[model samples]
Target: MDCLPLHTLQTVFGFHAFRPFQEEIINRLMAGDDSFVLMPTGGGKSLCYQIPALHRHGVAIVVSPLISLMKDQVDALRENGVAAAAYNSSLGERDSRQLLARLHAGELDLLYVAPERLMNDSFLERLREIPVALFAIDEAHCVSQWGHDFRPEYVALGRLRGIFPGIPLIALTATADHQTRNDIMERLGLADAQVYITGFDRPNIRYTVMEKRKPFQQLQEFLGTRPDEAGIVYALSRKRVEEVASKLRELGIEAAPYHAGLADRERSRVQEAFLRDDIRVVVATVAFGMGIDKPNVRFVVHYDLPKNIESYYQETGRAGRDGLPAEALLLFGYGDIPISRSLIESGTNPEQVRIELHKLSAMIGFAEAGSCRRGALLGYFGQRLEEPCGNCDLCLDPPDSFDATEEARKALSCVYRVGQRFGAGHVIDVLRGSKNERIRQLGHDRLSTYGIGAHLAAEAWGSIIRQLIHRGYLQQDLANFSVLKLTPSALPLLRGEERLVLAKPRIKVAEAKKEPRRRGTVLNMEYNEDLFQSLRALRKRLADEQNVPPYVIFSDATLAEMAALRPLDSEALLKVNGVGVQKLGRYGAAFLEVIRQD
Candidate 1:
């Protein structure tokens, strides 16, 4: 029992060692202590609890918010030869009864459930009758109202400690800021839990935010280089989801739409297809990506701006979950700001609205940032990167910044002259001296700042306005039809006491670049391409035969290891990184046959 974690890691999960903070967190949990884990997506958040659950006495109960995630994790665990089961609303009566019987009989290693189900009195009584090992709560941020994906069901989880006093509990989340983290701890009543924030930086993901220039065309161009790769495209509306999905199909890409507007069965089908790799791309809204566990998503493209940085980070975090090189492309324009603002303002909670607005501003700052994108992103999470990440758009080809003091002043003056109530477009029109009838009718043409900005084009002025908004000089008042309002901070700029240096809007071509190297691989090792492809084909065949995703069989990194270290027999094959005892018995023969042929 003392060596169970190491045994499980090597014989079941088939990893050489634990990731940075996993071993520590697992040890604490196995010691019958509560814990809080803040690891990024694909950072092995599951293993921290799964391994401990195996090490503990009774069945480990994992509270997850999404049914899809529950099934995916349970499937992956079973694939690793762990006796795991998921009980949720999706299960039939007979299935639920059998699972409950299994729980009573203590025949399961792990049991995944929803937070709502865990709060039931009958469930608590049933749990009390059995010796529960520990409670593992995934997506713990859902307990905090300040979190991006707030679910009311999560609030009831506070009773877990009160109900099962001696059982250890672990709360896990991939995204949480300082405020949200505090709220999560207080809400879950994990005051004495050992908190581990493993870091927010996903170095394998390359962040690229582009101006939305012909969005569909831009999307097609972005997808041109990633043929047959799995990814997600997020739009702002259901209409856009359908439009993008239809267009992707027209272009002969295997794509589908998933949103709240779709029927539950249709949505389930789409999600299952995606998990099975039947669909390579999913065009969706914000509703699509909370609990997905697909490991090999190669890219995540934001067709519109996400309302807050948390949402953006969580959405982008869905990619590269396999610890491979992934891309996050955000196609933003001024129009997206208003749409996101309106969505945020429509929410019922005032305090929540204010917090969301502030987050939106920070997200805009990331989009309009001149420096490192990763720096700004991680800075928001309270983690500082010492240097440029060298993977984002700015680090790859640094954008130039211009001293736009006069231009900013001119833009602010124009907003002020237009009664400070016009949106960016109307103000841009006034600044650029457009011969529009509305400007003439409003007599804004007579203002001193009317044509003062004509030296710059309307697009240029719009860029300046966006930059001002990002820099805290101006606030887009969604309550006032998204009119530009000068903040008190803008006084310094208006008084000519501050200079504004803004990054110039990038002009990009549609050509593709070379693919980035996958992370966690030895770059210096020369591999036989033929052998790698052969192994991949075998993996796909095995995955298809098992009716599971390819990565479930073995990750590309595992296959690369197999290709580089071609072993002759099972004894040598078992020495590979991902080949645990179970996998060696299940898949070693077929894979060894390929290597032996080579």
Candidate 2:
């Protein structure tokens, strides 16, 4: 049993068994084979490599992109009673030399390094002198230029096969489409690797997208409902990050801002504070989230739309990493679309620009979709859900669609009548037959389509315009000041050859429903709130004493299990999902005492 991955899983990681695909991946790796894993964030990708590292004869070399992530994973491994160390820019020369000495001496079971360090000729020469067990490339998607978080250094990983011939190399990532996956395999030279495509659905995270209206206010309302819950607020720019963080703090929330523009030390401090739960929320640009290993992030709020669906999926995947119920809220508007589109269009190559635009278009479709959000999101990744998921906003509150064929025709007529040069506002103005000076100046009031849409309110017209843009019936000339222009698809609709259906717009925020606690929470039982809070207090105190994040001691899920099951002794405590031998030996009594008193 000691040679079994299941044994290592229980004794070291405190789970009863390996998660789906973990055992298979570990088995293959132990047999000195390569693998390509695409499991979701909380799906136990780490254990796939860590177990093999332990079972193998020599130290496992893990190549990662971010220093922060390397440190976080190494710390978690050490906490699990594994000898792990990370070498990165954050370490001083003395510390680097010490860790390298240990690595060479085989005192470290796993050594994490950036791809740059791994690809360094000197570093590779040093590694050649040691007995290397295996090579793991985390965030394998980075090797693919099509992948959202591509790093040029990741392309160097293709050399590992030649450098360490016959050594098993496993590439792992949480997000990759079909094209990106192929690119990753080609780049890593893992064409013969066993490909494990675990389903990409994160059932624990409730997906919700809101129409961005007074975003800060909407964000405030969203955060107000979940008090004391840790979350990440993602903005699109550094200035917005500061503004949102300031606003959140002004509203009495413990928030911090993180971006690349900040000094490295300040960014590190903010990230460390966030990991330790010193901040309740972090307003960050895209720079902050990739390497974060914080498992208790209760929510991830996109204050603006992400660049594409891949970025959205990966960022949202950060939540509920501990297998607890979490939420992902994305607030977007038609305004965010052009900003993202321009960024993509500004790319150098025509083909790359086309690909990016297509990606942005898909993201916009997801945002404006009136169908099951989960289905649309997964569909983009080449996975199909057999039925509507009841976890997302659309499924929970289905919107009503109506035949708007006549409305579509009229809107198209207005766009055409306005010379297809004006934006939605001017078109709407002409449709409403507004006698405003601007319309008079443009002489649009005299047009045949003028006053044709007077039966509908201005806000209604706005929703129709947005839907048209999203539905591809019309394309906004983002390069030319947001002018409304017709795509070829609009031709049929305008000529009455194709009927159109549009969802009735939500005029106000949906009433917040009191959802029953998710079944995954505390093993789906009505646990004692006081007991859960007390357990958290104890965990915080213990974590503070050890100078580790509370989750490094035990996750919210573990404490929830303790609160619900009321484990009275070390034996019972060890049976909890997250309580392993190492943690049970260290903090079992303290947690057992808390449960015993109840």
Output the number of the TM-score-best candidate.
2
Tens-place lDDT per residue, model 1, 1-598, is 4676877788888887888988889889999999999999988999998998888999999999989889888878888888899999999999999999988999999999998888899888899899899999999999998798999999999988888889999999999987789889998889999999999999989998887889999899889977857999999999989999999999999999999999999999999888777899999999898878887788999999988888899999999886767899999787888888998899998877877886787677678776677877886676767777888877777777898999888888888888888888889888888889999999988989888888887767766776676555777654345578887878898998988777786544222244455533533455676898899889888888998878788876678788888888988887777788888899999998898898
Q: What clash count does candidate 1 reach? A: 0
Candidate 1 accuracy as lDDT: 0.85
Model 2 residue 454 CA deviation (Å) reads 22
Model 1 weakest lDDT span, ten residues long: 506-515
Tell how far residue 48 is off in model 2, in angstroms.
0.5
Q: Tell how far residue 367 is off in model 1, in angstroms.
A: 0.6
The lDDT for every candidate, in the order shown, is 0.85, 0.85
Q: In model 2, where is the ten-residue run with the lowest total lDDT?
A: 505-514
For 8-101, candidate 2 gives per-residue lDDT tens digits of: 8888889997777888899999999999999988888888899999999899999989888987888788888999998888899999889888
TM-score of 1: 0.83
